[model samples]
Target: MKGKNALEMCARAEYGEMRGKNAFEMCAEAGYGEMKGKNALEMCAGAGYGEMKGKNAFEMCAGAGYGGMRGKNAFEMCARAE
Candidate 1:
């Protein structure tokens, strides 16, 4: 609510589908994403290491941030904003 564009800052925050994971993956994983909840994998289908084919898997909780009801990320930071 200022001249600095506060909305932009929130958008930058790593939440929701900021990565290749379900919108509820990050938060839901803490307790539920799946009944297993053993590791981050339970949040999605990471194959085993949260990635595949050099690129992040579609279900990983770490990749690019975008798309609602679908998927955080380190490498995605360098990616051009879609």
Candidate 2:
């Protein structure tokens, strides 16, 4: 269990460092990867808008999925593919 936990932490830390972003930026509410800064539901509104457009959560929240979906993050820009 400890090893698993450590591995998870290591992966997270490495992910944060991949794009020169810190813990906060990587975990930003509006998302940190590609979405960067969309503030409307449109980011996660339709399809292939936010997630597919941004770098991380922005991929699942505001731009990743349909009726879009982190890959976007959160509710606003949940529509990308980070």
Summarize candidate 1's per-residue lDDT along 1-82 as a digit string, tens digits. 1221222433354555533443334333444324334433333443334343134334342443446312334223223233
Candidate 1: what lDDT? Answer: 0.36
lDDT per residue (tens digit) for residues 1-82 in model 2: 1222222332345453434443334443335345455433333332244334433433343333344331233423311212
Off by over 4 Å in 2: 1-11, 16-24, 27-34, 38-82
Candidate 2 residue 17 C-alpha distance from true site, Å: 3.1
Worst 10 residues of 2 by lDDT: 1-10
